[model samples]
Target chain A: MESDLVTADMVEATEFPHLSMRYQVRAVPRTIVNETGAIEGGLPEHMFVDQVVAAASQS
Target chain B: MALLQGRDRQRVQSELASLANPVKLINFTQELACEYCRDTEQIARELGELSDKLQVEVYNFQIDKEQVARYRIDKIPALVVEGEKDYGVRFYGIPMGYEFMSLLGAIKDAGARATGLAAKTKAALATLVKPVHLQVYVTPT
Candidate 1:
């Protein structure tokens, strides 16, 4: 996803409290989609892609 | 203590030798405020030292408002790994432990000017009609 229209940034939870709280993050490896959809934990590449693709379509 | 030890440093140097183009690592941190800021700075400095194609640019997070906003960096120890262009690869903490491997991989990928994504994934990405902002959060543990 990084090579194309997607831009991925890794955020450190403790270091970025503002961002963490913005997403209401309380667990590790949590991914928020479009700053809304909260995926609680790590997902497989296929699933991750699915979520992103879905979000893109919705947006 | 030095982060990259004797043989470890040598291994990293060899890996960095494969860099196809110049890679710029931009780090943002505020002194006397951010945890692991020193460690992150040290890592980027050492990594840049591994090869001439790599460069490290440090900026104050709180003071460098323009740079911070330009990169959209919202945290301390923020690192942006960019090649000829911004592929939007970002690291928000010290690349220590397992993440060090990820950092190396990112540098190689960025420097190579290509993503190692699967062919199918590339095709799928090619069909993307909207820009996606992906954030992956993780703990150092």
Candidate 2:
């Protein structure tokens, strides 16, 4: 959220039915990081940041 | 019908009062084929009414090719929360229910030209040289 290198898009699963199917979204608040890793459900702020950072750090 | 009720309206108004700069909600929608386009545009319009610092712009997703390309919008009912410069924050679909808070929060962040991410998180993000795309999938409920 603080970096210009990051772009965060909140996608409404129902409205974007095709995207939902593509991402295999089975529940609300699923976060797809770098289009590779999936974070299911809501996480605490620190944990969420950690996961996102880790995902971004991955090659 | 109004999506934001009395208490919700009050809350939004109060939250928007802290805005330090002008923010624009760039809404992309189509006249036909999109089920939630109208509602999404309405949300942008209503939020615009809540603050003088907020501006709402509506563009046809199909007709406005330039804007669509500029914002890299690929979906209908897309809303871009932009301030003086784009921070790459976007909302696709109607941000209702719980996601409403995210919209409000993004507006605030855009207006402030800063995110409330912790110092450590900011530091972590600064280390990234490659682009990171985050798509958070949610339902209105």
TM-score, cand. 1 vs. native: 0.89
- Predicted structure with the largest TM-score when compared to the true one: 2
Top-scoring candidate (DockQ): 2
- For candidate 2, the lDDT comes to 0.90
Off by over 4 Å in 2: none
Q: What is the DockQ of candidate 1?
A: 0.64
Give per-residue lDDT, candidate 1, residue A42.
Answer: 78
Residues A21-59 of candidate 2: C-alpha lDDT, one tens digit per residue: 989999988999887888889998788878888888883
Please report the TM-score between candidate 2 and the true structure: 0.95
Candidate maximizing lDDT: 2
Compared with the true structure, what per-residue lDDT tens digits does model 2 show for residues B1-141? Answer: 987779989989999999999999999999999888998898899999999999999999998999999999999899999988888899998898878998999999889988787888787778888998999999988
For model 1 chain B, the run of ten residues with the poorest summed lDDT: B115-124
Which pairs clash in the backbone of model 1?
none
Those runs of model 1 whose alpha carbons end farther than 4 Å from true positions after fitting are A1-4, A21-27
Provide TM-scores for the models.
0.89, 0.95
Per-residue C-alpha lDDT of model 1 across residues B1-141, encoded as one tens digit per residue: 778889999999999999998999899977887779998998888988899999999999888999999988877788998888878778988777667887889999988888777666666677788777778787777
